[model samples]
Target: MSDMPATPLLDTVDTPADLRTLKPAELRQLADELRQETISAVGSTGGHLGSGLGVVELTVAIHYVFNTPDDKLVWDVGHQCYPHKILTGRRSRIRTLRQGGGLSGFTKRSESEYDPFGAAHSSTSISAALGFAIANKLSDKPGKGIAVIGDGSMSAGMAYEAMNNAEAAGNRLVVILNDNDMSIAPPVGGLSAYLARMVSSSEYLGLREFAKKTIRKLSKRAHNAAAKAEEYARGMATGGTLFEELGFYYVGPIDGHNLEHLIPVLENVRDSEHGPILVHVVTKKGKGYAPAEAAADKYHGVQKFDVITGAQDKAPPGPPSYQNVFGETLAKLAETDARIVAITAAMPSGTGVDKFAQKHPERAFDVGIAEQHAVTFAAGLAAQGMRPFCAIYSTFLQRAYDQVVHDVAIQNLPVRFAIDRAGLVGADGATHAGSFDVTYLATLPNFVVMAAADEAELAHMTYTAAEHDSGPIAVRYPRGNGTGVPLPAVPQKLEIGKGRVVREGKTVAILSLGTRLGEALKAADALEAKGLSTTVADLRFAKPLDEALIRRLLTTHEVAVSVEEGAIGGLGAHVLTLASDEGLIDAGLKLRTMRLPDTFQDQDSPQKQYDEAGLNAEHIVDTVLKALRWNEASATGGGARA
Candidate 1:
């Protein structure tokens, strides 16, 4: 590490309590230095960058003004908490962020006293802050409770729900609306346009104060008339008439980067013992860094890069990522079929649907952070004779489980779900892992679940889902690059419930699902060296198990093993259910299932994570040998020889 001169104000403050000793001018210097540290740290670690950079001044102002560690401060998405984390005494370990036994990428309540509520998904801060406010009021420990949320997160319906409830309850809560006019991408929807209108209104502030002063002077008989006038004036001046109607003391459209304006406004809200207040602070995403300011979305999360040149490290060339393949394949399919449409929940570029959105602008929809709405909306589109492809990450898809069951499956709509990031995701850790989709969706009545073995298979599955006129169909693919397979000029559909046998052997059989087929193949080769002939089968569809193929394998092979890149309640559990029903266990056949253990895997590289979970080839071979009790015979070479 380079020995750059640290700012004196920053060096003296280790906690929020220490921040009180610094003067307001000194805090400005501290904010600048903090921004520099955040830029450097994230540049080295390659994690959330733009959000943190945008919120640096606001973070400093909040910690400086609020009595933190007692007065609760909640950050909505927690992607912007790097500045908060650094100032709260985690700076020394900042280099290890999002790594295996180091600091978490988001705000963790267990990690420090400063983080009151933790969040990874968007639009949760207001509810959490309200909970704290109510608790504080009930407990009689009267302190300020604040929720700092971004304009991007504000698009979700849940934020409005929380605002409505908070206003109705009339509690002393402060909601700092950090309006940068962007989420991951430039925000969409009527709410965003409304906020923009309010931000642009010239007479909004002057009219609000005039109405409040005029309302106070009116007699009891004319109070109703005063209220009516105030409402009418507010509706005309500020476009947040919807929020005021919900009963909040609305304040802002202020300059968030200017500490002079932000501090006094925050202090006024903090001191006022009023009803719920919403302070709208307009900021710029990637405020200070020039490269980041030019492209906020690209810098939102970035790879390690050079500071001076602002050039990101080039990734090694390999097979295209599964997300890219899905996007390209879907675009090609949509060219021929005008009925096909794509939908994403606030992620156009991340899910690789940006290309499709560009080509088919009229058919593409970008619903902001509202997964439930996305699913139900797709169902509606399907009902109208349009083929809707709902592209979302697996973990995020969990948010819309009820919609999948009620809207899509129950109605028997042909909504094709392209589930990206369907396995262990590296860097982002457990909260973002795509581990539970196979189990969760497989149990739904009218749903068909399938996993891709490689890029080619993913294309085939996409083609299959688009053509299938049956109920909802899902095709899940992992996060990273494919297996370097050659592309097909035209896509073809696969048999719905059929599986292919890769290698045939009589001693043991491995029924692999999804991306684990490659590992099973490698294990089969390794076992052959020890005189253990192994069979490998790729079960394409998880919901409808290929009973004939499974029965054939059970009759021919002495022992069988099931493998998947998911948890206990997934493919392995389903196979066991079949075995129990068919009385296969009573016939003296040995069985073993290899799935992720019943514990949350920690943060690590994808390769290391697979090895640790015993899902790799060497461990699979060992597990199969141990299960068959043929270890000694295999060592002596008395069984089938290689």
Candidate 2:
């Protein structure tokens, strides 16, 4: 271990104050070292590697310039905060990132004092920093508040809302716009155009300053005329008239990676005592690492990899990821249907739309981090007689709930939503978990909601959603690899408002939904050993609950349990709705609904979380036995089997 290379200068930093102690020259070295550490850490653990590597210098400069913990720094999305975490007393624990009981992948107020406002979602930092600024003003505090947001995040309406409010309020807030020219993938929309304008306006800045000085020397009337002329010229040149109109003191198109340039620029901004300012810093997404720089988006989020070659370890030779399955299925479907188009909110690769985009470039749409736009845009496509498959993560789909209700559902449009990450996402924690989509989407009128038991079912649901032309339909699937079931060669529509019994038994029935059916199967096997036979039923769709099959189970079985990988108001709640309406209590049937408890699950392994939530095989078996009053009889020496 002593023969090992010295720990990076970043590893030496335990807080911002420690970073402040470093010489400006040392910070350059620190940045290089931090970049290496971040690359290595992410290679080992698998996470948002590219974004963090990109921000090493910026992270160092901010910590060195600002009085953190006292002076709040909010990072939008926080995916790029790995270097921030390393600097802020988490260097050692960086190896355990996204693991059970490890440091979070994003900023967490509870995790560190340096992280003033927690964030995982985009377009929230400005709002959060403005809140801190307002609080500071109210409390008579003297520290500055900064929000580091990406150009990608700025595309969202919320970022504009915060910028609008911050500018209007005339608050002491500094918005560091980290313009990396990407958001997981290449960015989209008018904001991208605005950033392009800023990048190309370097010469215009000098001209504007010259014009300003020249205008001051002119007569009063000439000056007024020149001013209007200058405003028009500046607007045409810089394309920042929009931001200026928003009342922010827009600064820079600065080089974010250059320590010499960034340090002084940040120092100037820190001391200027201006109203809300937007400092646009243009940096490469994966600046230091050669592999990441070459394939920035691919390295944006990576699995464990070889640090030397930056080659990710081969996944254990087994089943394919659900994403791959979705991609293959979508590609197969799109080959036949010219009207079938795919849309994603800056997650083409993650959501498996990359294949669709590659195969059918004309039909595939990547709408950037604008989930709301993606939804309405799909609605537009649907209205135009095109079948739009709006694929988005369940958590992100929450951003466009109103659009789902109004633009799609209310209009009875045939916009199919391929909701990915539809359960507890293991490492990214509560913020990224797809816990509420089922409950939320199920409640919407004219919306059909379904969950896949496995990859085959997912393919079938995709087909069903595509063929169903009546209204909006959503099919949700989980994060990891699918069960090793052979996918169908051709897509087929399943009967709506239906479910299937996977295993037939008597005495107890387990009604499982989503990918949790596998665990339910395992539980069924364990219960079989205990002589308590279980009937395992997969309720495919959540919205149109198979009441007939459910009622049949309740009538025949001694006890019934509803299981789903979601929160309270999901499948369990829907079952309870049926139970209440049919007066199952009056019928003297024992019913237990097993779903995720109403609490934010902490950072842990997905399997660990499942076990903790009593959704694992052993726990499911235990729950069944307990519900059957087997434990009570065993305790009373009634000769119950162990």
**How many residue pairs clash in each candidate at the backbone level?**
0, 0
TM-score of each: 0.93, 0.91
Question: For candidate 2, which ten residues in a row score worst on lDDT?
Answer: 183-192
Lowest summed lDDT across 10 adjacent residues in model 1 is found at 183-192
Where does candidate 2 clash, by residue pair? none
lDDT of 2 by residue, 245-331 (tens): 777766556667877767766766666544676777778988988999999878888989888898987778888788878877888
Q: CA RMSD for every model?
A: 4.4, 4.7
Give candidate 1's whole-model lDDT: 0.83
| Best candidate, TM-score | 1
